[model samples]
Target chain A: MSPAKHPQRPGGRSARVRDAVYTAVGQLMGEGRPDRLTIPMVAQRAEVNPTSVYRRWGDIDTLLEEVSVAALTREGDEPPDTGSISGDLTQWAQIIVDDITRPQRTRYLRAMVSAREAVESCPCWEQRRGQAKDMLARGIERGEVAPTEHQVLDHVIAPLYHHVVFGLPTDRAYAERLVGDVLAMARPADKA
Target chain B: MSPAKHPQRPGGRSARVRDAVYTAVGQLMGEGRPDRLTIPMVAQRAEVNPTSVYRRWGDIDTLLEEVSVAALTREGDEPPDTGSISGDLTQWAQIIVDDITRPQRTRYLRAMVSAREAVESCPCWEQRRGQAKDMLARGIERGEVAPTEHQVLDHVIAPLYHHVVFGLPTDRAYAERLVGDVLAMARPADKA
Candidate 1:
């Protein structure tokens, strides 16, 4: 979870403090269940005082939600504009695989997932899905396929996360094959 | 979890006791994290007395392992010999979606998943995967496309568990689509 490459955020003392907090959350999550995390523990790890952490984030749940928002809002999360939805989706999926597969970041990613599950819908997750939808809309406009929501997420996105979380077959091959399957399904039915 | 189905097992006093214990484990899991489970709590819930519970199972880990074994061993879990592997899989996947969707079973299934993740590895889950492999073997023997292990589990099976655990898009249609994608992948590429 302690990655030198912080996902996003520019330089400033306030940003440093926020990065420290998010890092602490990621580190702690890597160790064990998210349910067991507490503000005091996170503050101690962040080297920030408990009072300030609470004053800013209010509670563990809120802190996690805000951090997730930061992770997804980074422009890096968007698929490259490779001129086709499937192309963009494949690249996005590969980045996701790479992101979670980083040796130091795996636990942090898992921890974030566990903690996010405990909270209401995270803004970052919602925002990511929205980005996917926007790409799909563009694909429809380009006459690639009729736009649909559930299939892409269910077939392509869901399986990737499942592999990472369950310790199943995961790697570049898994990501490529998964993208292949999604594109296979997303290709529109033949015209009469 | 505690469904009246009792899955599979001959009737007897010993069987009744085992069933009671499994039911208690499920009930307790629904209430809280599995690591937090205690013998006294299970005993109180099962009405079997703490000493007897301890004497039979030895520990929480063993008890959970045995319950999962019972679940996977149920004869009903077999994919019906519906003339083809894909036919059997679609039906089995549908049953899974329906089983988890049952109002009474939702919490029970979630509890079982929570408990399974806490133990070394879930016997029922392993057994289920084994079943998928066996069916695929039959497909290969029948001159069907050569099937590999990860594709079926990764593409076909993992998504269902992912949906259930994450509370993502879940419905009969989703399961059907998932199975369709797997079959489409499993099909011989040269056949296209």
Candidate 2:
């Protein structure tokens, strides 16, 4: 019988093992030495057998990818609805900058980037894009002239991530300025 | 005797060893497996003693830093001069996207970022800022309304690097669009 045919119950031994493994991965990533992470090391930290980690995640890259997706896309982490696109984007950008600029978060981000292989899609970026789409949809519903999701990603989100990853100075003011610049790209009707 | 008191000759054995080591580091980085790079591996690749590599560079981080700075700031690598600010920025942005989007270059960039420590400044960023300043200086001399160096960095360079690091879609058209957006921030006199 396929493993998919009998899904493990939540809070069962399987679920607890998965939770412990993910937590151990998070702790290791937090230590800021992604280069040293190995399956044996993670298994030791998680109190699980190395063969189990290998069987479940396949490899370090897949394990990292799963952990990053879980960490970045936390439940209830929706964009703010401040009644206008400008307000929403400014607040969202500030939140992003504030969260990502922390040392631990930066390390996690760098670790994720380092572990990535040459794939066409980035799950973390897709998550951010989905959030951007949610914000844009709200603004459109409110009769506000909204920038495209690509504009938000390119102008605001991309710049913020660029500054963080490259060790450039970033703060709420920088985030607000990016939001303002992208908002300026909206039609003249919005300006009027 | 202080090492600073006796600087190595430019074309001496020291310089030759340094060149060989740097080339080895670049080759290993291009191989796209930074996590496996070590002083011993680099020494083997460079045909130098591991003790010599450690004595010269101290550690992997320092060696990677020096090599990245050297590779990124190669001689005669300047932003294109297109006479007009818009043309110059558009061309420069496109060039940056083209160069950084290559698989090898992307791997090298990720390696550099992963190897970095929490420092106040980034040498590679400073190098790019210098190039941006040069482009702005030429635009000013040509009586073109020019954006500040920071503006160019935030709007154009940051976005390009962001896309590269995150595996997002980027091309010449995207680069040109960013150039246009930043150029739009110039004074109305130029717009007129």
Candidate 3:
């Protein structure tokens, strides 16, 4: 996984432990020996005391789950409001295209994807997705987009994700092409 | 990462060694420790002796590269002609949807994806993509599809990959909705 999972969220004592635990796990992952990983080992590295660590995270699986959520929830680029869904989607998707294209971020992105499948219920993923949906919603509110097509996330974003998963280029030109295809499909049936 | 990286390619002496190594790696991947994996360990497990394994594979990355090609190349589903590109695509995608949805295979699929990004060439990926492209080409030849818009893989397949990556259900109904979306996007401007 990439070193940077999420933008650090501000918090108090509990957040500090979470951050420490995050560091500990990140270091261990870098070392590359999950099989040898133990809760105590993480606790030792985090300097958080074993009992608290165990109390907070029951097992490795839960710990990883939380970490994944944290990573995905970190601050990210917001969807553009170019006053049109097509314009907004292109700009927004390009941000993601750029983000995932980064070698380091791509690793974390892939890690987050796999980690998401390991269990269930990642609020960060939901939050991220919600933002995408909101862009479509905004378009619909202005009547620039059909209400039926307001749920455009699956169409535009999914293709970008596919490129990322396959190690294919998700550059500006690629994003532009994909967005164009989607927009072509998005054109009013009578207008095309 | 997945055991069944390739369909067993028919050959002679070296093929046997490849098969043995394949089995050994498969068993290791089953235990879930690609990071901890060593060439000598694989060699011992395959009973091919360290020298031969070292001489052939040289390193874990190269060894894994070969294994991935094989796993991806493994004889699997065939894309049905189905008389129409849409029909053929629906059928073909459903097979992938089914293959990936299986709990056990999903693990291997994820591993294969991660391993894929770690290297350069993966012929198996190309092969699967070729099949998708073939469906579009066939549609164009039949004049059932626009020759100008044969590149349907990115739009259609990407959404399916999104579903697969997210561990979402890819039932027949879901497949139809996604396919319908793509078709809608594909429709000529006159047909609303």
Candidate 4:
């Protein structure tokens, strides 16, 4: 197994360096797909010694993992749920649309993709995607979604990452409409 | 730009070389993700000289562009309209699920990702995804999908690619159920 990856500490001399590296990596990812990301450029962008950045993250792949986790984790408060499927989904969809449209989130997605490729055996995406599944499950329990809700989680919310990372624009209104449509589609086949 | 990618070819030696190279690239993609793929192994698989393969394709990235085009083109046989949203989506979703679940398709996704990263400034993915979009659009036009269709296209269909390409064991049933749920969710807010 690969050695466990850790972030540079978030304070003092190390924090300054870590911030620079991540910021640089984000810029590179925003400008191009993950394959084009280079350590030299990342070091240049972050204003850290190339060797130091490499030593800390080990390679582009690991650096990307940190960036992706940070990106998903950094998004601000979710909109309040309206206690109805349409309201809940509309709010969630809008949040996703906003996140992907931001330059940083797309970059993080590209990086996470590279990391997934680099680590062939690990199921690292679960950490990133699990929260979403849990949220959908909550909706299911509240009767806002079907009991068998994993499919909705898999099909709808997750696809936004693929689109954003690939540099596609996913609009907000379209997102809301889709949420409404999907919730409707999931109704039991027998119920009209 | 970039010598006009995938320009139409005259028949003979160039065609033969192109065929051999793409087949080799596709085979390697079928085997595993990009990190695990090697040029020499692709050469061996194609039964062509390694130098010839490299000389012709220039590297894995260019070869991948060709393969991505080929793979995506194979998508979307016409679905029976069946006069209902669920029936149409069920058919289309099944096709996608079945195609992606195959071992070879998994390899192709992994390789295409590597290729996507390596090619710094190409919009090839737009071409690949456009096919799915067009297919979904057709469904929308036929009134087999809801008015807010692109969102459904994004969340439902796009996520399937993410799951399968990332080595998840997703299947057609899962896709159908998700599509169904999304359709249900699409109902007018007041009605829902």
Candidate 5:
């Protein structure tokens, strides 16, 4: 027998379930014990059948990875374009510092790192690299000399994440300093 | 009655037990499933009573932290003194990359980081800072411009660790580039 025809709906049941599961995971992560997060707990909080979550994500680690990637690389988020590379990077760095230093976000970041196996690539880092590439391209178009995206990742992003992971002070001032250091790399001989 | 006077032998029973426990932890971590590590498992591997392990270290996480710190900051280890800051940094960075990139060492590092709760001051970082300070002092005495110890940590050490934690490539060439970049920060205006 043929199935009954139905109109395709935007934000359908699947999308609604995904959003609920994501929100539940965020709440569990926000509770500051990512170690205790489990699929059943997420499913219960998400108000979906446990089988549905298991069928969708398969495991808690996969769920955490997906939620963390979404939280870290907010959809449609744009890098700051402040006319100058230094200003743009400074603002961007500050934004990162502020976001990751929050207790819940810190827990989420750490959970993501901890849950990871020996992987060749990190989606969050790749997203940041793409953003950095866009920012650098804009700076170059504006006739400003700039460090490569890798330089920005290694110098600015790496240090920030390092500090966050290691419980170091990740204040706005530290973010500004990291931005200044990377910018200084683009013009070395001027001061020497 | 007075206790019998035994010669206080260095590397005595207590030391031997600690060494065994540390070795066991290292071996378990090397197996690539840090989440499966338990005090009883470590005790069984160390051939020590589980009670003894519990009484001494209290928990697996604490034991992991101690073992990681000892392994990461080798006993009596010294930073390279290559007679120039650049050379010293390059050598030191390479040593770090080589040590931390080993599968076992990488697992140990990730275990340590994953076991951590939010707290101020990482002992391993403080030890590196001390080493960097000594290296910087020698460079200043040699009349070579040098970035501050904090700068060295933020640039070289932080990035290396960040890469290790994130499953990024951490090789000798990457280490050398990081050293070069940090040194360049010490002389910014000379390029333009």
Candidate 6:
């Protein structure tokens, strides 16, 4: 047999382990405690052996690192460029309503919250998050975004996350409203 | 002594136990399995009876919850508004930078990640998140924002969070650049 027996997914054995652990971690995070997340518990739920789990991730935080990366892969949809920046962003902003209400999104968010509590300095956590930021930055470079696009990104969406992860009433309608309001204020003025 | 002793800091009877257990839990989350977080391990490090630990928080999950909240409180800073949207958002975005870089923010994030793994359908989680959205909506009504704010809120700011909580490399310079870029695009236009 090959060194790794498990079937490969998007990123291969490492990916599968990451995916399984994230799924398991997502489930545990929903429960609200690290105590309930035993190796046997994850192995049983993931359909892998405890030995397999240990051989793969070795520990809960390591496993969670994998899980966090997987969560980053899933988020708001890309907006189709409608020739205008406002139109494109308006469409894009609407995507969060869909992202937040989904079951998996909530699970991913909770896991992130719980992980932030224990390991005060974790590189894995930063690496995965970096991917998403790079993705957004790439989008901005391709458009006419403001000088403070990053702040706009921060102020506008941080609350949505605060709402979503914390069990607040964030939804699609709110995202749409936020986008519209900001767009109105952000519209380029015509020269007098 | 009373049926339950409210643990005091510095040299209280339960203080040592609380500190030890809390530290152990943090270490285990970094070095062990989430489910393997047993009371015995906590008690051993705490030097208090396992029974005492159980009496205080009922189980590991409950203990983690309280600790997670406390840890997050320490990582938080009040958002300062500098009047104009430009100044206000600039300050607001930096807070995210500050929070993400703080060591406690990382630990708090880890715990949230673990908890999300256990319970995907936590009602309480949903409720807390809703309040944040409500705050944004209230901001809109207060005219603290222009009418079409949500789109910018959702599209621009949402991504910053992915960067911050994930420990990505988004910074104030990026925030300033984005803010100007988006605000330039947000100005309302006159109809011919």
**Which candidate comes out best when scored by lDDT?**
5
Worst 10 residues of 2 chain B by lDDT: B1-10
Cα lDDT of all candidates, in order? 0.64, 0.78, 0.65, 0.61, 0.82, 0.54
DockQ of each: 0.24, 0.51, 0.42, 0.26, 0.52, 0.17
lDDT of 4 by residue, B1-192 (tens): 113234346665557656776787776565554554566777787766777667667786676666666775566434445556666667767777887777677556655554454465434445534544555566677755363455545655677777765545578767876676666555544532
Best by DockQ: 5
TM-score of chain A of each: 0.76, 0.88, 0.71, 0.70, 0.87, 0.61
Clashes per candidate, residues 3 or more apart or on different chains: 0, 0, 10, 26, 11, 101
lDDT assessment of candidate 6: 0.54
- The better candidate by DockQ, 2 or 4, is 2
TM-score (chain B only), all candidates: 0.75, 0.86, 0.73, 0.69, 0.87, 0.55
Worst 10 residues of 4 chain A by lDDT: A1-10
Per-residue CA lDDT of model 4 for A64-119, tens digit only, reads 66776677656653434566556656676677788767755654555555555455
Model 1 lDDT per residue over A1-192, tens place:
233244244685557778789888877766655435688998899987787678777887788767656654554655566778878777877777777555334444444444434554546546657767877888878878633555566666667766655455568777788777766655444333
How far does residue B23 in candidate 1 sit from its true spot (Å)? 5.8
Better of 2 and 3 by DockQ: 2
Tell me what fraction of the real C-alpha contacts between chains A and B each candidate also makes: 0.26, 0.59, 0.50, 0.38, 0.64, 0.23
DockQ of predicted candidate 6: 0.17
* Model 4: residue A113 alpha-carbon error in angstroms: 2.2
State in Å the error of residue B95, model 3: 1.2
Give the alpha carbon lDDT tens digit for every residue of A1-192 in model 5: 121133135577677778999999888888876664788899899988888788778888778877888998774579998898999899899888888988888889777767767345677888899999999999999988899899999999999998887677789999999998998888726433
Question: Judged by DockQ cut-offs, is candidate 3 incorrect, acceptable, medium or high?
Answer: acceptable
Per-residue lDDT over B1-192 for candidate 5, one digit per residue giving the tens place of the 0 to 100 score: 122133244577667778889888888887776654789899899988788778777788778877877998873579888899988899888889989988788778777666667344677888899999999999899888889898899999999999988778789999999998898788835435
TM-score of each: 0.66, 0.85, 0.80, 0.60, 0.85, 0.50
Ranking of candidates on lDDT, top first = 5, 2, 3, 1, 4, 6
